[model samples]
Target: MAAAERRASPRRVRTALVALLAAFAVLLTGVSAEAQQRPRTVLEMLFGGGQQAAPERPAVRKPVVRKKKVRATRPARQKKQRTQAARPKPSGQQSAAAAVAAPASKNENAKTVLVAGDFLAASLADGLSNLYADNEMIVIEARTDGSSGLVREDHYDWTEKLGPILDEAKPAVLVMMLGSNDRQPMTVGSRSLASRSEEWVRNYEERIGEITEATKSRGVPLVWVGMPPFKFDRMSEDMVFLNDLYRKGASSVSGEYVDIWDGFVDADGAFVYSGPGVNGQTTQLRNSDGITMTNAGEDKLAFFAERAINRLLGTTLAATGALILGPDQLPTIQLPPIGNAANALQAAPVSIDDPSLDGPDMLLGTGSAGGFSLEPSPRERLVINGGGTGGTEGRADNFAWSEKSAAVTPSGPPIVSRGSLNLQSVRESGGLKPPEEMPTILDAIIEDWSRENEAARPE
Candidate 1:
């Protein structure tokens, strides 16, 4: 009975301890809630003994003033996503950037002049390099490939070659000359076109456009040097046609077309083998074959383009009045040709009509003693062969011919000699006979020829 009493007493003590702990915990929780709900003043915190003050009225918690909930809009999310995407470049674009990375120019202080084309262009470059040898600002880069032309892609492909050159050199100006060798047939894919054919010309022009585009893409100015005349007339004609194409192509790109043909030709427009050199001294300018120029000729060729290049480069002479040409372009002016001491230029008089002023007969007609004639020469008459009895095989037709009155016909019309007949009186008056009463011109030619033959016999 004592043991049972002991167990009940211990159980009662444990219950009382648990009840006390529960009351203390409830008090601590209430204090914590009150402290958090209301801020304390310094005096209250010091004197209030950490006890929560009772409110005058039952306190109602102010509505929690939380920031207004912001709902994310679809457009804003989309915009955020786009900004993030733009911050990072796509993988494909990164690969492209790697592939197309360009090479920088090696020399910036020196203005690079890219001279490229066939043999002629090489010669031009040589001359220009020599010309600018002392020039500190210019650097001539010669990239000529002889035997290369627009037609023969197998030899060299300029379109493919130019990009790398442009990237590496970054030339300020591009000078070229190529058509001298491109006058042959061109084969495009499976088809073939004859030289200078309509189709060939189109293809050639397109190739030129490609070159111009490649140059202009890099912001380089182009100068296309035209081909000089060839020794053969037919080849010269072809060169003229080619020059037309070059001019058109150059003009399309706002490029300069240098016409060096006149510099290489004579006053009569014939290909000259000898001409004034860089020093104005007469020198052999062309090779024996007449196709290529000599050193002197090449320098002369550059003279034609020097002024233009100087303008483009903004080059000017120093305070001294001098030429931009090699050292000085002004040649020593020589006195006029004088045949004899009496005919010296200093002694010669400037008369209104000086007989000494020699020129072609077209400029100086024969003296008034001989009657001048404006009649059509026998050579100008067209010889038309027909059944005629004028002792001639063909009938000449400068005037009308009639077979009805062949026997009694006079020469078609009187051959009016100029300066001797009044044309107005002749046209108005009945000076011109009818075609029926006029003989064919064939008889007149026959008589003239026979008379000339007689005059020449034993004379």
Candidate 2:
């Protein structure tokens, strides 16, 4: 029995040890779980004393894919085919070229208009060219030296060269726009004369005469275009002086002078950059420099010259650029012969003073029908003779106090006099009763007060 007891005790001791080990294992597992959940301190981590928690991995989002929009593109082969189809055909190209060259070719036989002078004349020629571009009957011949002037004979002698130019061009009209560059000194032989001096003026006038003589000798009409006002006040003043000279020179040779001053000036006569254009709309006419003109300005500058040319040439240019010849050049029309000229009625000429123009030989009141009456007409007697229109016996105008007896008809009732039936007699006979008199203000007020009293007395 003792040995069995001893063996049972050993088994009991082993069970107790196994239970303690299980409890210790459970506690260690709980501590490890807590350590994992709680974050470690800096000291604990540095000392490596406590178990450090592993960092939780961040949630990874799925990548979102977008669909790409596809475009319909033509193939290179189709694009090339379309481009080739768009190309102009050979016939079309030829027609366009012909159309472009038509104006230049048509002007080959056009009458030349010789434009001669300095830089302004060159610009004038350009303007005139544009003006007559569509008119095939006229051609502008620019014989201008941009740097040439009457003062600078050494640079270009216009007087010496103008004669040859006129001969060469054989211009229908000579358009001269000079003196823009003539403000400089003039060289008369060995002396350099100041501009606008007596000697310079004489020399300038002589040069002008030379140009005019060339045109006069050639029998070409002259049209001298005056310079426009510049931005510079001094320059504009100089232009005015030059224009006066131009006017006299042109008039000396029976040339026409075109005054373009009012065209480029404001209401106050100052220079302007923008103004009423050819079409009358406000547009920029002068360039920024104010010495030169814009495209529109050039066209307007030509407008004055155009009128002179039209008058000198005796030709009217239509809006469509057609040239209408003068009356002398018009075709004569012959009328066809009548079927019977001998049977045509012939009217004799009548004199206005014969007094038979209105089919009356004598006045209506005159007794004679064939001869003129020596007696005056009633109107003439009233106006010239101070006569009165004697009133008729039965008329309303008769003011005689004596009452006339009614005229008796042979088979009818007695005729009543018109004067007895006048408005005064009718009123006396009570034919038209007079209007009743209106109540006075006092009576109206009294009547209103009586009505008020009656109302107050109570109905």
Candidate 3:
């Protein structure tokens, strides 16, 4: 019974100790949590803390008030001033704008060069404009449709439009470049004709003739720029054919035809993407598509047409800014009247081989000239007179036979020559000794037999 009671007492004490530990842990947790909730004061941080601390008061709240919106009396003026101050200076922009606008400004009597047809014509106009940008008397007016061509008259008929454009623009010159987009089948009244067919070519040529006639009737100078070779072989072939037609049409109307084929082709007459440009530098002339031209190509195209335009307009006008004088206006050049025919200086006809033809009475080394006697040179003596020193006796070149006997005396030295040394002379003079004769086959055999006999005879 005592053991049971002892055990129960220990258990009871253990229970009481556990309860005290739990209660102490709860109290510590509560104090730590409360300390965390409230911020440390300056005094607490500087010194130490106690259980009875001062409580934290609630933050004061301010009253909410609304302010009325104030409107400016001169808002527009203020805004304008603000905008003016904020705006950036357009110095560079203004200069760039002026540069662009400067090219467009021209004299009131500037001659208009009307460029008509397709996109190629438009590019041509751009090039011409750039070329004549400095010349105030020239202007390039482009009336082109990018997709228009002679084949599709319904879309844009150059035949009908050219007359009106000529009258309206009153152009000094009419430049046309088309047929690039005309490779497709062309439509006739009710029947569609295949591209490049005999019938189609006839019809196409007729349209070209019509445009040519219109320009001729209007009294405006016409310039038809032929198409350049394309990357495609078939397209290039068609262009060649079309260029021929253009040439014929232009010639019929007395229009100038500018052939730009050689410019865009290689040595073998194939299309080239890159070629010698206007300045003769190798550059990319055609675009990647090969159908369209790059800026350099456009300039090159203009270069060909520029010549024809200059010729028609009179080169003096383009080159020196001088007026083209007509036949009547040209100053007559009256050459001085020739003196009496008898007193006139005349030249006599001389033979081609005559040495006197060079202004001298005789050859250079022939004889005296102007009181100076010139001796004949060695070359002149040999070639002209066949005169030179004869070969020495006993020399290789000396072919003359000697009358002396063939037998030579052993005591006397052989004859010595000046040009070359002979073998006999060399030996006789003691300068060289005669070589010992080599043993013949019979002699060698006999010697060998004699040696064998001697050995056999007991040596």
Candidate 4:
């Protein structure tokens, strides 16, 4: 019995030791997991590759250098992105923040002008607006779409809306481009600006006068964009007429006519979208349908335009890839054309007070003789007037009539709109398919082309 009790005591001691070891092991595991949840530097993350242990400091440096370039190549937009990366990038969007912090500008920088049209304007507006890189000199906002006839109430009264901003900004430079959507006709004088382009010519002259006067009032320098060519499929001939008007009219203003088309225009005013290829084969600069640009296209445009503006502002930026020193953008590796310097600008386009009740391209809808018409309405000539969208989902119809909308035509009235077609019974009826994101090739082509092409010309 004594032997047995003695053995039992020792056994109890061993069991306790085992239990304590188990508890200690569990505690150690808990501690290990807690450490993992804490923040780590790039150094701490280096041990992930089946690494049983962390390497010393000197060992990490070389690997990071090699990996960085490789990882950066994952994106193709590195040209512009590199500049951004060089800046102390804050957590979210740096573009919006940069514009907000940019101080007000003064001097020729304000007057030194560059202008772009629609899609290009949108790109520039978001991409290169008020960068604060150029000291108190450069200011540009190009966001007018030509497809919408730029009348007083055109596209949210852009001229009116921009009036206060322009006045307050007191720009010395003004660049203008528009007239793509002037396909339809309206009356400016007692005459119609319709299929009879001669009438349109007079109206165009009068309208341009209004714009030039506005710029003069503000003492802004002016650069005017002439129309570029569209693809042969959609607007080959019509574009020529309009482009010609742009050339003649732009010349009339005594404004610097930067014929965006001429530099890129072919003998037939055709636009090729690319630089020369390796072989003698000619590569196109624009995309397949001829309006939107590829990457190289934008690169050339940005390079030239930025250089022009940079020179106008008299910043010490080299159009060649020269890195900037203190308070300057890096050197641009671009070659821009040096033309005769622009003349001093005068005033802004002033509103003319004619008793005429005409918009740039307002239509009186005659009932449908509809064969391939751009007419958006049947009963009343669709007034393709521009205004606020006012939270309407399918509000475009209120602006212009689109026969292309997926809305079902009512057999009853000839006066239907795009928004109405989208919002109506055929849409809401049972078993009807919901709207799809499908855009036809033509539609896609036009939309894409217009955006890129428009970027070169804004209202």
Candidate 5:
């Protein structure tokens, strides 16, 4: 029975192989029909024949559709360029000029001074104008905003406004002073900071730097006038800090910083409302508000700034106008003639015979016992007088001196005249000496005392 089953399995396998061959022939016929309807590549056929065949008509390149380039006309381009160039560049100075009106006619040779800043700057302008009023070569152009500061950007911005004025005025020198109205909170975009805060100081300095850079870019010198002391102590203190920022900012850009703080302060650094005027009399420099300056105060402020301006301009124009008349053009001095003035000498030798130097003709002591003589005596003698009552009051002492004789010795007693008084007590006391020696009065007195003592000794 097992052998019969194996023979039956072989016949079954042959029947299964014939059925599989029939199915494969049916799939080939279906693919050939689809290929004949539409073209297909080897890659498309391998990829399940989803993609269409590439169109082949000698591989046409679509005629290379090159666009004809339209070049601009040289004349038109030049005209457009000229129009653009003709329009003034909106520079800092130009914008500043547009914001602030300036004079139309100005001297080309004159030195233009742009006095710029806040309220303080207005006074500075006035002072500078008056200072250079006599000088035809200096033209003061004032560009000031009273209600402006670096803090208030909404009202006025110095960094944005200065460029235009600088452009139109073309100042040879810039005199600037601000920060008076800046002692408050500053708002930059959404951020707000109090004055003197770290952020605000940094921002303030940046604005000053921008202004400084703009001025220096034109190769023009700048003079930054420092804020003066205010009437209030706190206000003055804030000004000090602001002035420091100005000094550093101006100095960093090779500009001059004119310190005017001390000019408005006392020795103790306190703010003074009424101080010494420029003429040395006490005058009000600041108003009752203690912020703005008076006319005299403005003059003083300009006095500080003028020093820096004069240095830049050299003041040569002022010197050129000074009139220096020669001696020929001056009036001659007329002096009156003095009596014997031409013969008079500043110094002269002493003259013994001059009548002006002669002694009086009348002699002294003439009415007395003896007359006084101007002439010197021929004989020389030392006169002494004892208290004798007979002599005249005008008589001098009668002590006579004699020249030495060959027979007389220098050590011998002096010879006495018969009329001379003899001190008898001296002779009795063994104090008497031979003629030719002079006796002192003390010796005579001692001898007289000795004689008295000897006599009184119980004899």
Candidate 6:
């Protein structure tokens, strides 16, 4: 009988065991099949029809065709298998070459700087290096002050001099402060100097036009700091004329015209040192000098240059630096051992733990008084027991003075109620409301103070 049972449909029992095991495994996981949120595979999500193995197409039923939803796949992100046929495969060399040839964008702060001038330019270049050393900017300034790089003359090798600086620096701004020693007559290559100042002006215009062309081609904005009148004797006339020529040239360029000349020039525009002509700051606002400027003169000129730089850059140069010598580093300026001005420099830190701090500038107080010993201004305050009559836990509150009160003290007896006391003439102002013959608590306090004062008096 056992053998016959074994042969009787063992496949049925095996099928039942698989179903029971599958159900038991699902149950042990502690989530019902309906409660589980199994994420569909990408292909199943898009194409659908992935349920219960493929159902056989029955001959008795009509054919079912399901349209697939089109998904927007990024062409650049096609899988490797798709890439195998969808696009041309490039060699490693080709990818790198393409990357190298791509156009790149530049930001302002990342651009280089081309500074052109004499030794002053060199110092500026150095200062800038130290100034922007921590920043990201390149600077180039010539060390030579022997010749001015004016439009033309013996030292007309600007392309050799300034050209290389511009090329290497690849500057977005051309900072030029020139004509300090350009007394040699202006010329066009090998041509003669302009006859009259008017012709000289026209010829100067043409030469400047060339310089502007060179600058514009490089996509650099020119910032021309024009010459200040020289501050010496002898060749003052030639120097003054040269300055005017510089002014005209500066105006000709599309760049900003930094009128540093005015910072040094006299009202008449001639060079002088004293009297009505010298305008070198200390020299008064009267005259222009051959060369040099006072500290004030230099400051004004520097300010002019700073403004032009700001305008060209479309914002402040964005200097982020500590002063070379901060007040903290230097001896705190020894204010005169006495002066009201001493108050101007700093504000002493103060915290208001003692509320009486808001009292009269100069005050008299007993050991029991909580208000300050002195105050700059008389301030009114409310006190429940601070008047010495209220509860022991007196509250001091800032309050406005009552207008009706006739008398007041700078700091008064603890104010028990809302009322005004004249900051001045308190004894006379706060006299008792006279009665026929009775006395009040105010009377008692007064009597006590009087007795104390009498006892303290000399025997």
**In candidate 2, residue 296 scores what lDDT?**
73
List, in order, the clash count of every candidate structure.
2, 0, 0, 49, 21, 23
What root-mean-square deviation over C-alphas does model 1 reach? Answer: 36.8
lDDT of each: 0.74, 0.79, 0.79, 0.52, 0.75, 0.52
Higher-scoring candidate on TM-score, 2 or 4: 2
| lDDT of candidate 3 over 1-459, digit per residue (tens) | 999998899899999999999999999999988887787788987787733455989989998899998875422211001122334557664333322222235689878888998888887887787676655677789999999999988898888888988889999989999989988998888999999898999999999889999998989999999998998989888888899999999999889999999999899888899999999999999988998878888889888898898787665555334556678965674444534333223567778999766786766789733321245544555689897534454545444455223653335554455567686666689887668999999999999999999989964
- Candidate 5 at 458: error in angstroms? 76
TM-score of each: 0.46, 0.51, 0.51, 0.40, 0.47, 0.36
Candidate 4 runs further than 4 Å off: 1-117, 123-139, 145-147, 151-162, 187-192, 248-253, 262-269, 276-284, 303-459
What C-alpha lDDT, on a 0 to 100 scale, does residue 295 get in candidate 4?
Answer: 50
CA lDDT of 173 in candidate 1? 82
Candidate that beats the other on TM-score, 2 or 5, i.e. the better one:
2
lDDT of 6 at 241: 66
lDDT of 6 at 225: 65
lDDT of 4: 0.52
* Tens-place lDDT digits, model 4, residues 1-459: 999999799889999999999999999788666655556666667755222344556745444344444443222442222242346666775565453232333445243343435564443333334233333344455545634444324354444545565666555555565655655666544545565366556766566666666666665656665555666635546656666665565556555555455545566656666654323345555677676654544444444345444543445543222333543434643334432222212455556874443554435685433233232333323234443322334545354444335565456556556563554576468546768799889999899998999799968
Go through the candidates in order and give the C-alpha RMSD of each one to the true structure: 36.8, 25.1, 20.7, 39.1, 34.8, 34.3
